[model samples]
Target: MSRLYGDPIEVWTRDGEPTQFVWHDRLYLVRRVLDHWVVAREWWKTSEGDPGERRFWRVEASPGREVGSYELRFDTAGSGWLLMRAWD
Candidate 1:
């Protein structure tokens, strides 16, 4: 099992597939920080534009980790890069 030593993060995907993520315009390799079970589906929204079931993960790296306490969204129906939640 991979351990998180420095920072905490959250990542999302569709069907739990491995994907490449970019941070600060640089690409970083990503893997599940824990197990295959991470993400939680949105239960508050029932509209057509709401997000569906999402897989979550904690991506880690050096000082500047690619992802930080942010929620990522991957939709098979969209184009371009996936969307990432803002860091507070």
Candidate 2:
């Protein structure tokens, strides 16, 4: 099963890559980055040179012994991190 989330998370990065994140008061360490990508949409319609793109990292992470798949999003415009999804 997969769950979607829009909750803000505190993330720590190394080499501009997500290394750890805290969500719901739980700390999860990134074990591996499964994928990394960017999404930009309707760029021609937006103003201020904003491409409306979001940086995403799909990773395998764990707060404890059990590792889970997580998708983290970085909002370039706001410089905020969000927990986008989780897989169980």
Candidate 3:
């Protein structure tokens, strides 16, 4: 099972893919990308030519220890990266 969180985090990306991220004062390096996909964003919000989509990445990461699974979301509105869910 996984727990949900909407905490904002700083993520470093290379070639449009996440390489590392910091959350709760700890840094996690992405070991592998488990999955990647996009979904439509909130329907209540609308903008010109905006498809309203949310970019998501499920990754296996580690903070210098055993790996864990994480779900991350990229805020399209420019708020930044968010730690959407985690499985320890």
* Candidates 1 and 3, the one with greater TM-score: 3
Prediction-by-prediction clash tally: 1, 0, 1
Best by lDDT: 2
lDDT of 2 at 75: 81
RMSD in Å for all candidates: 8.2, 1.6, 2.1
Q: Write the per-residue lDDT of candidate 1 for residues 1-88, one digit (tens) a residue.
A: 2322322223323455544455455545554343233344464654555545554333432224544343344443232233344333
**TM-score-superior candidate, 1 or 2:** 2
Q: Which sections of candidate 2 miss by over 4 Å?
A: 44-49
lDDT of 1 at 32: 38
Per-candidate TM-scores read 0.38, 0.89, 0.86
What does candidate 1 score in Cα RMSD to the true structure?
A: 8.2
Which sequence of candidate numbers ranks them by TM-score, best first?
Answer: 2, 3, 1
Q: Return the top candidate by TM-score.
A: 2
Model 3 lDDT, residue 58, Cα = 98
Clashing pairs in 2: none
TM-score of 3: 0.86
C-alpha lDDT score of every prediction, in listed order: 0.40, 0.93, 0.89
lDDT of 3 by residue, 1-88 (tens): 8999999999999998899999999999999999999888665676655646679999999889889999999967664789999996
What 10-residue stretch in candidate 2 is worst by lDDT? 41-50
